[model samples]
Target chain A: MNTDWKNIDAASLNNLTLGEAEKLFGLEPNFTEEELKKVRNALSRQYHPDLNPDSGNIMSKINAVYDILKNEIKNRRNAEQNNANGGATDTSSTSSDSTREEPEAENINDNAGATDNSTSENTADEPEVENLNDNAGATDNSASENTADEPEVENLNDNAGATDNSTSENAADEPEVENLNDNAGTTDNSTSENTADEPEAENLNDNAGAANNEPRNENSNITWEDVNRIGVENLTLDDARRLFNLEEDFTENDLIDAYNRLDRIYNPMNFPIGSEEAEKNRATMNSIYGVYTILRRNLINRQNVQESPTREDTTNQSTQVSMNPTNEKADNSRNDNGDENSQNIPSADNEKNDGQTDRPKDAPTHNEKPALSTGPTVGDQIASNDTTPDPEPIPVIKSIPAKIMDHRKQILIIIGIIALAIAISQAINLTLVAQMARNGNLWHLTAGVAEKAALHAKNINLTSKLIALKSSYDSLSGVWTIAGQKLLTGNLQAILRGISAGSGILGLSCLTAGLIKKKSAAYKEYKKNIRQLIRDFNDLSYDEAINQINSLRENINNSNELSDREKQLLLNQLKKAEKLNRQFEDIDQGEELEGGMSL
Target chain B: MMVDSIITLANNKNYLLLMESSILDDSYFLGVLLDDNMEPTVDYVVLKKVEKDGVVCAQQINNLNTLTQLLEEYGSEYAENYN
Candidate 1:
């Protein structure tokens, strides 16, 4: 019936996470109430998580999709029932089939809570649980056969029942999803056991039939396991060369096809992280990603190596595949897969009506799909869980409570969080204000503005605690600035006059003292010499007088030359002379005096 | 000895030594010890007056030794400059 198998191929729903989809298909999932219960019971039996073989996990993913869809339907029914009865559930007895009607393993977990041993056993019983579905399906086919103009339900698992039931095709379970989902459960654990035992038939089916139908991009089947096992054997990146009957030189498109083939099989999101299986698979997925990276790198390297004549492009060189064949590990190169890969899911009309009949009779046409996250729109809810290769939708409604409760709680929490955030923000703002005050030259700027306005404000020198101006300058800057300008312009010589005035008084006093002093002719001569010394001290260049006076002063300080009166008189005269000479000691004083400059 | 005596009195009294650098004309030497923050220290050896800074323009024992050695090395140069 899938005449347009390729055309009718619905886009895969691989992107939706199982739990998010589960929200859409809550306890009463995406499937109808009746159909959800049927699929739920069947799945609980098939994928009794703990008891299923490691390989049975592929089936578990498929069944998880189914369980989520069923739960969504159940939740919708429960919500409707709640609305009908004013929002109170009588917890009288959870055994009233409504709880069972919910698609979650919760009822089972709750039922078997007292029996821990049964958890694994319940899971182990999942494969056999489909048997009950088969019986139920038998009952439905008999009943629905007579219904006039009944819409056909697309069940995909029809053909795989060769090992189980004779009428398995008519009991097609997920027949529309056979290429993707059915084999998912098989690869993880069963590949090792099954591939080793039944390689020829299964291998041929996957390698040949699966590849062409999948297109160059749908590389979901050639799993990490396939990549790990395939080596350079029948199926390799170079496998395209054999298919097209060409040499190893293949186009980029061929490589992409091979990579896609390899990609479809590796289940990166198969299990949750930190789970034992997920951790194991993490390593495996990383290696698979690494392999793809290597293939890309190899192709690029080969292209570069061929094109570059000078080997200057040393970066493109790599050790050939055989040399590091086994060392080539899988990586998360695809784990960081971009948005383009996950962008579009299947639209409805193009879906297949493949005559997949392996599904059990009486199982609802809208079998439950794997759980995915909450979809924003109703269409998304359906689309997220629509794993069917062909969109064979059995009508579902929009009934589950919009995440209003979550939104309300979030709003309240956000209000509290924002209050706290505001307090912190305010505190930070205050600290910044304080820091800004510390940095600003508030006093200096006012002083500057004052100085700018006033004239003859005898350059006030103020050192401030606050820094304000662009240079963080204090009022002292004005003094320094005036001083520097005066210094540069040779006008600071006037201040030196104050220092020299003291010396002039002292020199005249020394002259008078020397004239009054009584002594012999030689003492009079010495007194005369002293008077001359005072005149020269006043008249001489500052350097010459300072040198002579300093020498004499040192000698007198060291010597017991005169009596106490002589010493006291000499000291007073010396103090005045030294004061006069001190102004000239400044380099600017001597220079300005000699040149008649003002600085 | 007299300066140390004055310092001892000052310690008992409420007066404070605000500035530390000592200069006579352009000839000045710094003997003050300061803390990491550059505050003057006064109490290395004293308990109550934990000197944040040191004695101003005085040769301490270590420095006296250093100065003796420096003088021995650069004594002639200094003498010439003095002359």
Candidate 2:
């Protein structure tokens, strides 16, 4: 029996993450019930053990992955449902109690009600307490009033009067609501509706503070054992958050608070360096810092992705293309990727195509891509909310020729600098050689003086003195002997002359070669730029054509050694480009003139 | 006969299972390593394939370290077959 299972191996399945597990089963993290059902049906048809009995192991892996994802999705849905139910319950309870409570006490009552059930009892028992006070009043008003009843009635009336005074002075308590709103970091509009029927949010801060205090207490009491026990090596984002004692929906402020708190305890400065305890503390601090940084970076990336998925996709693809080793292939792949991404995503595809055609080189900048901000806003709803199959943006890949054109100036400048350095060093060597030749002449003069002295001694018939002078001359001459001069039967002086001549010739040749290389490289680059300019002219990119022509001219002018013939050739090309540009302008002028005539 | 056939294929044929998760599409493939005789061997191998300019190239995942790095960079759906 044939099986359509993807054929995952054992090792691969061993370390699968929840996200990867979802992908393996072809389930989206936020997949709807219908989508999940569809995926389940499709996988079972291909990998059901009974259907494809031969691939029992493969079927088991599939079921295992599916089960994990199914449970995860089920849990997420249950959480969302519970949140919805709890919100509804809280709202109903607030509205019901606010109906009977005094306006001034409503804010305090709402806060107390949200935190504990004591406010519910307060509201429920208020009417009964008032009725008891009324009965005591009726007894005191009777002819035989009990002394116990009189004091009770007075206490009840005092309580009623106090309640009445507080409720009647609700306007005076408005300033406290403002203070509460300020403390809560909420809008003043919430406090503005206290006189209206809506439940004032004055108590929200107090209740929320009470609710947060419990978690804050627990988190503060978290021990080093709780933190150090979490292994940082394979720590995922969620695990890192847990180690930091952060909530499920932690904000940047919360992350910073956790980091600061953790850093204080684990800071190695508290311990002596080189100690085992210090080392352990240092490691703990590093892990905390790593977790904080990773969380922060992931949060920023998620924001960027959520704000403009296509732009992020485009940026990634461009980076990848830039990193590619093979220029020609990378260029083609980038274009293909752009097109492919465009097809996968609808709105982004339209924008990408518009960008590709509108400004082939610089269009991506002016197009909708740069307009996308990193911060998410409601304005991006129209652009980003489209149900594009893929969220990745297509990378605009320029061909090798275009990229070379962009960097051609920089390449030439670098080459020029290298050539200049070589020439300067060679010139310095030439001056040193001249100085060495002068030194050699001074030695020859000394030898000539020794010969003169020997001749004078011979004239005087001083044989010993003449012999000494001759020996001194021979010793002085031998110092500059070329290697293997005697074996070659060459005169030492002649060989020395030959060595000087050879070096001089070699230096001149190298200087010429360096110059020629620079000239030829520049000329080749100029030709390439001219060819690109011509192509641009043909493509009716007049502005780019003009720019290239000016650049080419500038390069030629900089190349001082360019031959007259080469300069003439470049000038002719420039003339042709300028003529074409003029023709384009004339054509535009003619169109305008025709329009004017018709008008 | 079916069980024996499955066992024989598993023991004798060098089969590499791979999944290519790309932006365009995700595809599953099996690569069979050929021996000196240009025939399939029992020893399997895993390779990382990159396609550029319509040309597809692959690099072998030789060790556990390489495999771990590959899984981290790419997703777990991709695996290299190795002997």
| Number of colliding residue pairs in each model | 95, 5
DockQ of each: 0.01, 0.01
The whole-model lDDT of each prediction reads 0.28, 0.33
Interface RMSD of each: 41.3, 25.0
* Candidate 2 residue runs with Cα over 4 Å from true position: A1-227, A233-239, A242-254, A305-599, B1-83
What is candidate 2's CAPRI-style docking category based on DockQ?
incorrect
True contacts kept of 1: 0.00
Residue runs of model 1 more than 4 Å from their true location after superposition: A1-12, A15-221, A228-235, A239-273, A302-599, B1-83
Q: Give the C-alpha miss distance for residue A417 in model 2, angstroms.
A: 31
lDDT of 2 at A350: 29
Question: Local error of candidate 1 at A192, Å?
Answer: 32
Query: In candidate 2, what are the lDDT values of residues B1-83, reduced to their tens digit?
Result: 11001111222432223222332222212233435453334333334443446543343333222222222222222111110
TM-score of chain B of each: 0.21, 0.35
Residues A60-103 of candidate 1: C-alpha lDDT, one tens digit per residue = 24433443344344345666677688756532112224433432
Error (Å) of candidate 1 at residue B57 is: 70
